[model samples]
Target: MPERAPHGTSPSHPSPEAYAALESLLRASPRGRWFLAEYARRNRTAETEMLLEAIARIERAVLKPAPRQAVPSNV
Candidate 1:
């Protein structure tokens, strides 16, 4: 069985590896992507909200801004 997350709390960071794999799969299969759209169109508002939330989480986790470098001091 796959490892399960505990109830009531979510992970801090989404798995980048998993995200890449899923993205590749979706991109490779137009039919699969179309199925997702069909399901979303047929589903209720809550279903769309759920997908939006998940996508947001992944975007946030993997697209964090890079840390800035300090300016050099004048001599």
Candidate 2:
């Protein structure tokens, strides 16, 4: 039978060396560069949209427009 991993740790997670090797391989290829760019763009767009939505909600809830004051009547 295969041995189990220690408590709080899993075999599915890659070690640091394995992760570094994979990162170097990805950084070395043109297609990988394109993939990384697209991933970053998508992540940035999602974050921007969420921020905009939060700002909108805050404006609606806390930033009410003030009432205009009436102009003084001419003598």
Candidate 3:
């Protein structure tokens, strides 16, 4: 028989760092990003939707725009 994990630990649950790294890698790949987006859409929740909204907002703010400054009227 296979050995079991300790009381609070499970093989199915990886460390936070591992999950972060995996998420980073997935976000970096087109296919993986699609998979994540589809999974999140299929399993939507209030919190999940909020998180996705926040992520989209941040991505738009950071990745899709160039900062602009107001020009002086006299210039």
- lDDT string, candidate 3, 1-75, tens digits: 987988998678779999999999999989999999998877787678889999999988888767699999998
TM-score against truth, every candidate:
0.36, 0.59, 0.44
lDDT of 1 by residue, 14-68 (tens): 5999888876787678897887677678786778889999999999988999889
State which candidate has the highest lDDT. 2
* lDDT (Cα, 0-100) at 56 in candidate 2: 99
Off by over 4 Å in 3: 1-10, 45-75
Model 3: how far is 7 from its true place, Å? Answer: 17
Clashing pairs in 1: none
Clashing pairs in 2: none
* Residue 9 lDDT, candidate 3, scale 0-100: 82
Worst 10 contiguous positions by lDDT, candidate 1: 35-44
> Which lDDT values do the candidates have, in the order given?
0.82, 0.91, 0.90
Order the candidates by TM-score, highest first. Answer: 2, 3, 1
